[model samples]
Target: MSHSGILTLLTDFGLSDPYVGVMKGIIAQVNRSLTVIDLTHHIPPQNIHLARFALMTAIPYFPARTVHVAVVDPGVGSDRRPVAVALGSDPNAPMGFLVGPDNGLFSGVLSQYPALEAVELTESQYWWTATPSSTFHGRDIFAPVGAHLASGVPLQKLGTTIAVDSLVMLHSLTPQRTKHTLTGCIQAVDHFGNLVTNIPASEVNGQTWYAVVKDVTVLGRKTYSDSAPGELLAFVGSHSWVEIAVNQGNAQSVLNLGIGDAVQVILNQPHSSQGD
Candidate 1:
């Protein structure tokens, strides 16, 4: 908190390895005063889509001027370009910064924030040490670049500006909707066993509905304990998305639901509080 700005780290590298430590070491060496927060280090190796989703969920919670450095690159030694991105309305706006490969990891972030500005991390000399390992640029290249940016160096110094359309974006998962039914798939399962679905709350027209996951139908509730303390229920999450959870237990374990599982929301029937 002592630093002028925030620098957050997100990576597919698990915490057991020295990779996260090495990246932090490089950043600390450059700007000791900068505050560094670890958004996540266990992102399921090489899962760029998962990384993208995690970044989208975590970045908005941080204050403005937070630099987010994400490294879920599976194409480290390949032709993929190392890049830095900023998301905000104005090109000169001081907001979020993303450092990673030009893979589809930026997809979710770009979708959420349309006014995105990006640039390739082109200055090799600005990178740490004399020679950077092609495989570990997270420590050698990205960390140093992030540290410099967190220290107030202009983003234009990172590289030449580019069009937002030029950046790579993955195809987003689509939510299917009918007259009174909305179908979506489980996008992710967090450590807590909460099934995060692709369905956002905005898509639900009614206050109550039936959340059918797999073959089990859980009555939609407004809160975790809308049923009983240990009962399974559905609720609109803080992210404004519907999630199936147990009040005092793990829904993923109790119901055996995982990522990519199908979920359906059936709207309430006339004169009935719950959907059939």
Candidate 2:
């Protein structure tokens, strides 16, 4: 393996352990000059859907040819295939490579770059350890193959090619829409405790709507700052999705919300005002 562009790491293995460090060590052994950036290691432990969203939101910021290794495999030892994906509309020019389990972790990335090619990381020639562990493929299989890909190895050379359509899709993460309402699940709760919903901001289009989260209703605000301090409000978040938040406070703490909680955004009913 030779020197290459950025190698990113996204995992549920928090910094409290040596799992992340060991993976990087393997990458370093393969290509000492490869710059490894920690995209994030705090993925909430085996939460594949959250990992999918995080990857989707963050990948566009990196330069082309970046190799991303994301490991949030709760089914690590199972029949779930270890895989590598190359994102590109053109078969000849790959945007980048992603190495991880074949679970929904890569679904968002695949959705954005529909032309991407994928393959099961079956070839031991690309992995770090000959006898890979059942539980820790992140350190053994994913890390080294990502390093090899960063070093300019062809996608096909890694293993047998699989269609992107065949990858495990995170279909449930999408919001359900009706004539008067858009229903979605809480994809994640950020550090600030804002509930990030799968409902895109376009669905509401900044219209007057009321958000029902955890059975509590709050009128939509343009921004968190628009609402009174400690008052719960729903707004278009940074990623262009509707989020449940509290101005100057934590919604997750105040409202007892968690990931996968249901959220609904419905068109606000007009009141019969005297002027109207």
Candidate 3:
């Protein structure tokens, strides 16, 4: 199917179980012709920060009016309201719908499109079942509501309007910087064992800097291949974040670093040029 009538899913429910399939089934049941895209079912099991980051990276590629349903809800069935947000007040901004729990899973996407309109998904009739299972609202609540939105249900009719300001925000854990040092924590370790940090690519600037990992000092390079095999290399990763990797090797294994481990960039001197 083409991207029209699109509904995207992002969740921590791995494909090893039937959870992802069940949600797709519910969405299909609502509108079989609607194109349902799985952004990912592997979001580190309620790691909302990672889910938020993934959304920001992926949403830009979808067509306007695509409905994105992300469910990394750790507070599922709690007071955290299910929500369907229509992104952007500006007619020129890419129009779309974001459906999920109001627990900040969409915070990264929301941050980029600041004029979005949101609503609490309180209307039971819009859900797949009136009596939703407490733990699996992804199937009962989010899937159906997102399907309906893709099926042409009015966003306002989904529930009461909410102030965009009222939506929960994930803690913005930005990197700290001083005159010579920039400090950040590893936010994720990817499948290849590259350490993704909170440090922006703008911080590194392709300049001469010391990457302080444990007791080792490696210079920041513009690409992974700039370092020799098995050497620790710091580079601006594909996600535009500073990442630590071992060329042709795994940094997570070699450096013994995981998420939340500190990675520092100590500048030797200011650079003559900046990097994108």
Candidate 4:
């Protein structure tokens, strides 16, 4: 089911602006036959942590060889390197291309797919222009480069090879597990205001769990129905993380939470103290 010659774009640039459209236009100009999928255009501006989590969750569903262009760059005009990463090309691995700035926006997906090959986009010829706008690398660099990659241009030819370890990775909050408590940080806030924690859902599988955020102890539930309407509850989200949500309500508003907010998850009884 791998869709070749397909490119997926994710950006903090909302639909109101022409930025996302312009990037698509550049991609189309480079390769008219390629299919461009708009993964999303509504990522909160400058929210790299949320961008990372979104990419991580969505990439597993895309077919192999789809190029992913993510632009949540806060350092667009700075000296940050523009990068294109080829990941998970092995037999049973998830294969895709990640195109964006060298910031940690790609880190979440990289944790799962480990880089097969990565390059700094130094070849100006592949970009839309020789003198790209310092502020908008999305249109000038990432768009065209991703289009070229999806159009079958080789990865190495795009730019200089760099060590996978050298790539910038965010020191995002990793969940710490004790016998009965998991301490982590919120990594994303969904449209419904459900707070997604860095803690993996598997940790509390088949066990009772509750979450404490902003000093409120939320009851654990198997689903939203476990709580009354507008009541905040915690549950394992369908993806990979634990989510704190209020049934038919905005948890973000109730908790006054945002990304990086501290989260304490209390689970019942003993599990092996692996991450302690």
Candidate 5:
């Protein structure tokens, strides 16, 4: 494994604490020349679901071989395994490394990229220290392993090879489609209080659609602006997921919708008979 020169860190550890900084320092100590990027540190504390979504969305834009370190572990100091896994398979597919605990945090990325190889981080030499703290493996284990991976350490050298199937996984809600409706659930509420659904934008491509949930319905539009203040607007976010927002209000506060809340998308245009 040659050094990729780029590494990204994603964690629920907020900037208010020194945890994020310490992890970065560990990585920097391993490879001084590597460019380190922060994916996000404000992940809402133990909110691994959003962390998964964030990484899955951000991974596509990174260059191949860029090592990604995600430390959203709520199971620290437990029996949970610290692991690093390589993802993607196609020769032209965008593939990279995911170093973190074997929690559901990396499952969203796995849904997008096939797991090529995986290993349990049992080797102490590749870790930050041989006597790692029971807590804060993000600083003790994951950070350094990711740094070593970016510093040209082979995946196999860092830990014992393990079956990808043995790794824990996360299952996101799958959107369902009928001739005139799309059934999905709210996946997350973003910083701006946008209600993000699992429905893909392509589900409404070339058709008119409206989103309904919790007795509130909103028109589908290209943007959530230009509407009257406090009016709801449903649109496709930059991440390509259907999102509901208010013109000048907080959708989460206004709509009172949250993760796992059911969202029904009603198609207004004529239904195509070709696929029916």
Candidate 6:
């Protein structure tokens, strides 16, 4: 079969390096007609969780059969295995592909879809050049392999089949819930300074609540304008997660909150009216 799906790239190798570019070059060399999109090239160094979250958010936006290649391997030079995964719960949908280290970066994606197919990438000579480098497999190995796969190569030809249980999984953000209270932690801080938390919108519906962070209670608002510009407000975010943001300011800096900080949603009525 001829290759016809989109190939997407995600990595912590910032644009300053020739790493990402070289990978693309290798892919183009294998299949010139393949379309490539750069999801991001600025993930924090070795921040696998951030990479996983970024991948999950971008995958749904692409058309079916989109091949996603991610490389955030801190253990690149180590004994870790490179992998290619096809994600989909329904057997009929065009399966999504992931080419990267066998680290826990695929955790979030696998969590949302349990029946994903996984395989270890073992084809060596078929890589970009005759000899591959230990430190930069993204260019030598993953890129070429992904391009070839996108070009209609059967996944089984890449390597031997493996059970999903054998793959690595990262620990995702967990939200704790009580009678009416929900507690979660900040998972990441985006470029716009918004603190993305683990609390989902389903946890706070039909209830009045306060987002308590570092002892400061941020009032829940229906929208950003419900508060003065640059003032902090808590609202249900685009991903169905409750977010702490400022209309035109950076909530991460303004509130001095960082990842793993404790955030609580107290569902009880505001304290001021309790005595009335």
- Show how many residue pairs clash in every candidate, following the order shown: 0, 0, 0, 0, 0, 1
For model 4, residues 47-91, the per-residue Cα lDDT tens digits are 998889899999988878899999999999998989999897573
The CA lDDT at 7 in model 6 is 96
| Model 1 Cα lDDT, one tens digit per residue, 1-276 | 222478999998898889899899889899888899999998888988778889888878988778889999999978888888877886556558888888988788788887366788887767896577979989888999999988887777888888879899886558888887888887777767787788898876465577887667777778775687767787778767788888878989987877778898877643233322
TM for every model, in the order presented, reads 0.88, 0.91, 0.88, 0.93, 0.93, 0.91
Give me candidate 2's TM-score against the actual structure.
Answer: 0.91
Candidate 2 segments whose C-alpha is farther than 4 A from its true place: 1-4, 271-276
Clashing pairs in model 5? none
Report residue 99 deviation for candidate 6 (angstroms).
1.0
Q: Which stretches of candidate 1 lie over 4 Å from their true place?
A: 1-4, 229-231, 254-256, 270-276
Q: Candidate 3: list runs displaced more than 4 Å.
A: 1-3, 91-94, 268-276
Tens-digit lDDT track for model 2 on 1-276? 322478999999999999999999999999988899998999888889889989888888888888999999999999998999888886766777889999888887777787478898888988887799998999899999998889888878899988778889886557777888888888878878888888888888847787886567777888867878988888888888788888888989987878778888887554222210
Compared with the true structure, what per-residue lDDT tens digits does model 6 show for residues 170-207?
76558888986788998777888888888888888777
Clashes of 2: 0
Model 5 lDDT per residue over 1-276, tens place: 354689999998889889988998898899889999999999998998888888989998988889999999899989988998988784333278999999898888888789988989999988888999988899999999999988778788888899998888878779888888999998878899998899998898777888878766677888856467878888899999999898888989986778889998889754322211
Evaluate residue 15 in candidate 4 and report its C-alpha lDDT on the 0 to 100 scale. 93
* Candidate 4 lDDT for residue 125: 91
lDDT of each: 0.81, 0.84, 0.83, 0.88, 0.86, 0.81
Cand. 2 Cα-lDDT: 0.84
Give the residue spans of candidate 5 off by over 4 A.
90-94, 269-276
Best by lDDT: 4
lDDT of 3 by residue, 7-104 (tens): 99999999999999999898888889998888888888878877888888798898988999999999997899899888867644438889999888
